[model samples]
Target chain A: MNMIEAAAVHVRFGDRVVLESVDLAVAEGEFHGVMGPNGAGKTTFFNVLTGRVKPNRGRVLLAGEDVTGLSPHRIAAKGIARSFQIMTLFDEFSALDNVMMGLPEFRARSHDVARAAAGDSRFAAKSSEALAAVGLADKGDIRAKDLSYGDRRALEIAVALAQAPRVLCLDEPTSGLGSDGVQRLAALIARLKGRLTIVAIEHDMEFLFSLADRISVIHWGQVVARGTPHELQQNEWVRRSNLGKFA
Target chain B: MAAPLLVLDDVRKVYTRGRVIRRPTFTLQANLSLDEPDIVGVVGPNGAGKTTLFEMMTGSNAPTSGRVLVAGTDIHGVKYRERDRLAIHYHQSYQVRRFRKRIPSAFLAPSPTRTPLVHLFDEPQFNLQDGYIGFMLDFFRKLRDEGRLVVLCMHPTAAWHLDILAEIAGRFLFVAGGGVTAVANFGALVADPRCRSYLGPEMTKAADAICHGAVHSST
Candidate 1:
């Protein structure tokens, strides 16, 4: 069954139409990638899915329920979670505290950070489970500020996992990561795939191709192509869009 | 020898959020100098301080230690208005309006009346369309023609721009963990472990990936 779907989505800012009649569908437990050239309204599509940017007209369905036009907080409550291109963690907090802050119960989860709690066993257990899921099991005590860049990103995902989201959205999760970092993240995503419906916007086509079961290419704010990795590679427009660079 | 047009003498920037919660901290630790009008490709993974370098150059954030020099004058010592005129940082969005009316002066030629200037652009690939990418590349070349220094900062995602810049960019400055490491050209860049290791697979490949239009340019 399609866990998430967008129908005829249209989003615009003033005279600029960022997203035009965009449609996307993701099956349950599927890893979906979004690829586009720069300024293709890819970011807007991301925002629309996360409920951060409400489409001027359209419908967003999360598990067959209407989620369009909802605030990011409401969407998070609906089991949708997102990590940012920029680190949104409270730098001063410990890894455990950071993950705890990502729980839906821990204040809305709109990248609006909640104060880190010193010792809450209940939150600690939940956050620990999350940290372990992302392989940061022993690093929970380390401050978010002190974690290595790769670990910090993992912690961010752990935070999202703590929410127990059905659908997790990663915005350029590997943008700043090194080769080792990229491999580490790819491994984490690989392990998490069957358990979560994952949607990612990635510029690194290699990472996207290796991890995404299916991908949809957005151009001019519309999804011009959607198919398996092999199909996308065969696409003329995707090829001309410099898909060769990634190869 | 005339001093370099730009210099960072052990520059550092620190942040202190709360007295009890967080102590003082430093994010940027830059120590480098550049003299030529080389088209320097500023690249690193995210959080590598590529943007911070531009910020320090534009005088938006004052470094906690050391100095930033443009034409031998300390940018930190000058008022923001003066720094604004000297250091122009162009982000990807037109809404920024910070450096609106920005042109390719450095790539081509300066106004002749103004002092020799440096234009710092962070991720100029944003919002660009299909045909316009080449246009922007040509514009930067024009700036180079005019005898201005251009620092083109690109995130790994936009590393494809490196292929285009490589043909013209005389140097590649790899920023990792806030420090600066410079390579002579694209040949040295891909060969250096720093460039390959720091960038993701696509960007690493792009370090040597030549734009089709300029296949012989040697990325």
Candidate 2:
């Protein structure tokens, strides 16, 4: 069964139509990539998938159940976790603490973050495992603000991983990273590819072309083109452009 | 019989300066009927009211006079939220414009069709670097094949851009000097004096080459 599906999702912000009948289906363990020019509503589509924005029409199905219009927290609770384009991390807390906060077990015990941070052993172990998955196991004790940029990006993923999510939605994961950082991030994502389902909206075509099982080219608030990297590169213009280097 | 796909009946839009004096700054007029499903390319210079024409066709901007009919339904009379169901206007990446909702949607009728009969793409970015042109061109053809009229408006800055319009569009509309002229084919479009002036020297030469079979498109 498809793990996550957006069925004809339509979102309009007042007079401007942002997403016009967008349909996307990600099979289990599929690493789907979304690419588009700016202002083409890529982020808005992500918002719809993660329940940040409610669709004016159509439905979002998670494993065949209608979950459209669910609250963000509710959607996250149902095993769909996301990392934002803008990093959201606790600056003063240790990387371990940041990941622990996202743990459902830790949150279930208490809303008192300070008390929960000191009272957990199993949660801490799970947090450490999550950090290790993102290659930040040794950086667990370091303050989030003290970590390097690349480490911070991995730490954000670690935070989502701690939730044991079925699907991970990443928005512009390689935006601020340098070439080396991107390479390391790619290696990390490669390790997790088959184990987790991922839908990433990325501008770096080389990264997506190398990693994604399939790519959807979004334009005019719709999926204009979609195919594997090889299929998309078959165009005459694509063979001549810099994107051809990936081919 | 089913109604014509799209009809612009004596449409006119005038933008006036000075609310008190109301002196007209610009005026655009178009009266055309496209009765079949096909790709129609629209080309013109900047500020030639092409965007205005598209907005009016999609029912976002109400024509100063006359009507825009999509499958015989008056698009402007349809509810604002439902207008896209009859005719959707896909704006250029940078060209985001909003028009006032003068009448409340409560008073307007719902869209007559579930899917749009007319699809207008305004200056879709055809970047060579992205190489999505082939897919996009195929999509336009797919829409036409499904029996929907496709209106593609583009400013052909490069020769390849003109090649795309020639290879894809069956007919052409040249918007200039506050009027719309329908050119029967790529051959006629390059030969028209106004279109030649709009295309300028370099592009006109390239277009002529395409018309004369000297330039072969790689598509």
Q: Give the best candidate by DockQ.
A: 2
lDDT of 1 at A77: 83
| Model 1 chain A lowest lDDT segment of ten | A235-244
Cα lDDT tens digits, model 1, A1-247, are 7999999888767534567558999999999998776787888888998888988889999999999989998999899998988889988988988888777766542344443365457777998999998889999989999999999989889988899998999989998899999999999999999889999999888898888999887755657567787766653323444453443
TM values, all candidates: 0.53, 0.95
Superposition TM-score, candidate 2 onto the true structure = 0.95
Best by lDDT: 2
**Tens digits of lDDT, candidate 2, A1-247:** 9999998888988767898878999999999999988888999999998999999988998888888999998999998999999999999999999999999778878899988888778899999999999999899999999999999999999999999999999999998999999999899889989889999999999999999999988877889788899998887667866678799
iRMSD computed for candidate 2: 2.4
Candidate 1's C-alpha runs over 4 A off are A108-116, A236-247, B1-219
Report the error of model 2 at residue B182, Å.
Answer: 1.4
- Report RMSD (Å) for each prediction in the order shown: 17.4, 2.1
Which window of 10 residues has the lowest lDDT sum in candidate 1 chain B?
Answer: B107-116
* lDDT tens readout by residue for model 1, B151-208: 8876655654555566557787888866788878777777778777876677666666
